[model samples]
Target: MAWALGANSNSPPFAPAIGANAISTMRAAFLIGIFAAAGALTQGGAISETVGADLIGGVTITPLAASTGLLVAASFMIFGVYSGYPVPAAFATTGALVGVGLSLGGDPAFGTYQRIGTFWLLVPPMSGGLAYVTATLLRREEVPETVGVPLLAAVVGAILANIRLGVIPHPERAQGSLAEAASFAVGRPLVAGVDVVAILATVVVAAVGFRYIRAKTQVSAEQGIRTFLLILGSVVAFSSGGSQVGLATGPLENLYSVELGLPSIILLGIGALGILAGAWMGAPRLLQATSREYAQLGARRSIAALVPGFIIAQVAIALGIPISFNNIIISGVIGGGLAAGSAGVSRRKIGVTLAFWVITLVMSIAIGFGLYRLLSTVLGIQ
Candidate 1:
């Protein structure tokens, strides 16, 4: 499941960078693998817990149950990955878990489903709207490249300051952000009900990002734009890993935590290795197929597409939501493409893709439930 999940999913978020020639395919794959592993190790904990425990109520997932559900989900995802169409891996995994939980007599987790479903519904318009605004800003005559590019960089930096990571000490599942850690290290001084140190840290990071992008632009506008795209893609890839590894590792969370008496980090590490291997072995081909053939975006449009994916991925990670990065990136691509006139975008393909997401979710649920029940009956385990 981890291997197929890695191969099928994480690569597309960075397709823009490779498609734009901002980075070599081999190098980008290498960096993506590394960053993805880093992200999984550092931030996969909360998401893993959410999936393994919170998604279904009253059922402690047995190893057999986990294996059954994952087998069903992974088989479907592998078919979609090879068919060269974007499949919603998150939907499959989430639905599979729900189905298997039901087979085990667990009650429906409507609250969790509601939260995830709402987020999934919002991805299209929110990502498209943001991408359109960013692309428009990049194309504006009044906003110089130096100012506009740096402004976006500053915004990313500000967001980066508040992203939670596993390395930060926390009371429970809630990890601390960089800004919070900095404030704690110095002395939590409140300025008008705000952490003074966190505010200062945010400002400093944002200013530094702004200045750095501006300086890069000063050196060479074209190179600077490419450089920013590469950076943005890398961030999106990292965020993708954090948001995605959970789908593969979530089932194993209960297996490790209960029976094996192992840490969740160990499961994350296992999934991370699978992601790294997938990125190294299979990412380049998928990257080429999606980027070169599907959408040939230039540097400006690529950046616009990536920025929203990065932000949305981070938001998903922070909220412990399992997200399909392809869904986010495709919406951004459509928005960015439309900004330059919709000549390159295909309405039919988009419609088909949306329909596939819903179908995958419903079908996975049915498959998981039936498969688990059948296996339990034949094996006399349940």
Candidate 2:
């Protein structure tokens, strides 16, 4: 499960970087593997809990059911990896879990389904719109490079300041943002106004950093954009780990206690390893596909696309929502492409990918439900 999810999910964050030639495929994979593992170990718990326990009601997922759901989901994703179609792992995993849960006589958690579905529907448009607007602004001749790039960097920095990190909070409480963690470290109580201060400080620091980079003799405007895009790629990769690890580990949460009796951390570690392996071995093909097929993005357009991808991915993680990085990246790529005109975008490719996403959702559910019944009956375990 982790191998499949990792291969599919880990590629998009760095695809734009690759497209812009800001980073090499191997370097992106290496950075993605390390940061993604960190994210999984630190912040994977909430979404895992949501996937394992909150998606259904009235029954616990037995080891057999969990394994069946994961198998169905992973098989579909593996098929996508080999076939060169980017299937949405979130849709597959969520559908599979719900299917298996229903087969086990669990009640539908319609409210949870509604929340997840709403986000799934909203992310593409939201991400695309933001990227389109950003790209448009960046292309304007009147927008000075010094002011425009730094202002955008400031916004990204502000968002980063507020993102909840898993390693910076009390064990029993939810995570804290960088500012809150800093405040705690300094032995100051977290007041209501502290976030505003943190935001301002982050923006100022980012603005200064961008200004410095721009002033460097070796760093051209294009190079500055590349550097920023690489940073955004890393941020998005870390967020991907936080969001995608749950899809692999969620089903196994119950099984960890019931059968294996392993700690959650250990399960997370296993998932991280699978993700690392997949990122190293299987991610390059999809990375090439996304970077080349979706859009031909330059450094400015790449940054425009990646900023929203980073923000949206982090938002999904904070909300414990399972989202498709493919959806996010493709939307952003299309948005950036649209900034150049419709000619830059490939409608046929988009249609095919969307079709695959819809088909995978339905097929995964059916497979998960049918496979569980067949496996349980054959093994006489249910």
TM-score of each: 0.96, 0.94
Candidate 2 residue-wise lDDT, 1-382, digit = tens = 8888678887888988898888988888888887777778777887898899988899999989999999889988888888888889899999999999988889999999999999999988998999999999999999876667767776777777777766678444767777656655656544674645555556666666566545631357776777778878887888888889999999889889567788788888898898888888888888888888888988788878888988888878878888888899889988988898988787999999999999988888888888888998899996
After superposing candidate 1, which stretches have Cα over 4 Å from the reference?
Answer: 171-174
Pairs in clash, predicted candidate 2:
none
Give RMSD to native, each candidate.
1.4, 2.1
TM-score of candidate 2 against the unseen true structure: 0.94
- Find the 10 residues in a row with the least total lDDT in model 1: 287-296
Residues 124-204, candidate 1: write the lDDT tens digits: 888988988899889999999989998999998998888998889755445888888898887679988978899899999
Number of backbone clashes in candidate 1: 0
Backbone clash count for every predicted candidate, in the order shown: 0, 0
Best TM-score among the predictions, by candidate number: 1
Candidate 1 Cα lDDT to native: 0.85
